[model samples]
Target: TIFLDEIGELTNSAQVKLLRILETKEFFRVGGTTPLISDFRLIAATNRDLKESVLNGKFRADLYFRIAGTSIYIPPLRERPKDIPVLAYKFMMELAQSKGVSFGGFSDDALSLMMAYHWPGNVRELKNFVEKALLLSEGRVIRARDISSYFEEHSEFGRSLPTKFDSSVPSQLIFDNLQKIWEELKAIKMKLSEIETEKKLSSGSETLNIEETEKKLITSALEKTKGNKVQAAKFLGFSTKTLYRKMKKYGLR
Candidate 1:
């Protein structure tokens, strides 16, 4: 049997060669003329959407059909919150045994925070967090504070904001503050427009200050939400796509 990971990343020439081999089940040795018959099972996997790649001309339709006998789509970690504790413990135990640490398990609060997290980087990120927490945690159980810094760092929010969202705070108050910030931003834009009209000059420093304020708000939202982009967007009074575009514009991640 042959297993190919990321088969969609095959070059065009390589795809042609693979297609020929799959069709004939035969190939000549590199330095030989005689064709050799080979039979084997093939399994392939990729994180990319193969059909989309085919549409984009990046993947060959024939080759994709050849290997796509069966396919499985595993949702990302954030989509399956229940799996977080299971995978987190699995990683924790494996890492603890490797490092010869006598750790008991994760605290309930720790697990809760993790479940609420968005985990943008998926399983690998989870494993990394578990390992780091195990190393940092002093007690038998890993507490929320043990792994809280990981979210802040991975969220790429440079400023020190609240470690987690304050659930006790009224949602209406949060929205009111967000609305006020939005209004302030609009006022700044209007001021900048008036200045441009009167002086016929671009206020570079004022524009820089506005950008800095926007970045801070976005960062604070992500930190408070524990890296959950959807929640952060709502907190900032932005559509999810707009938040993503703004994050990209500011090179936040």
Candidate 2:
């Protein structure tokens, strides 16, 4: 079986080559003149809409039709909230067993946050986050604080923005915001590259100072929720106890 992920990212030349192979069931090596025939099942996956790509001339219509013999649409994580806890626990248990650690599973608040999160990165991201949480967790139960810190450290905008369509916001505004976010993400990537280079050149023992970042995130959440710790905790995916501890530690009281 041959599986191609992100098939939509293929160039026109590559697409034409692939289409030829699919149609003829034969392929020639770069330097070889003879064609090689093979019988194999091909499965392709792409996040982009292939129909839109075909209409936009980014993808070949023949190639799209040939490859899309069967289509399966798996909804994003936010769209299927019910599956979050099940997958989260599965990942948590697998990680724990692999690491040879005993875990009591996630706290109620932690589970709530996992369900509430928009999960822009989807199942893979959730699995990674759970693994990281399992590793970082000091107690038997994975707390909301552990996962919240992971989100803060990795999230592009310091929080998971809703991936669902909102009727309240204008379409233009949403597009503008997405554009701005893309630019900011590019800048952030460049900055991170520079920092990584500096770290490699230096001791390599240095790590990101997440204290200030966490403080800023907490403050922002608090401000947005109007000093309501409970609301702030939910927004930041932190337990109320963890939020209070952070507030005290940061002298935000």
Question: Against the unseen true structure, what C-alpha lDDT does each candidate score?
Answer: 0.70, 0.71
Candidate 1 weakest lDDT stretch, 10 residues: 204-213
Q: Candidate 2's C-alpha lDDT? A: 0.71
Backbone clashes in model 1, listed as residue pairs: none
Most TM-score-accurate candidate: 2
TM-score of each: 0.55, 0.59
Residue 84 lDDT in candidate 1: 74
Which pairs clash (backbone N, Cα, C closer than 3 Å) in model 2?
Answer: none
* Candidate 2: Cα lDDT at 7: 97
Question: What would the per-residue lDDT of candidate 1 be over residues 4-100, giving only the tens digit for each residue?
Answer: 9878889999999999999999988899999999998988878789999999999999998888888889876765665677677557645755676
Which runs in model 2 stand beyond 4 Å of their true positions?
152-253
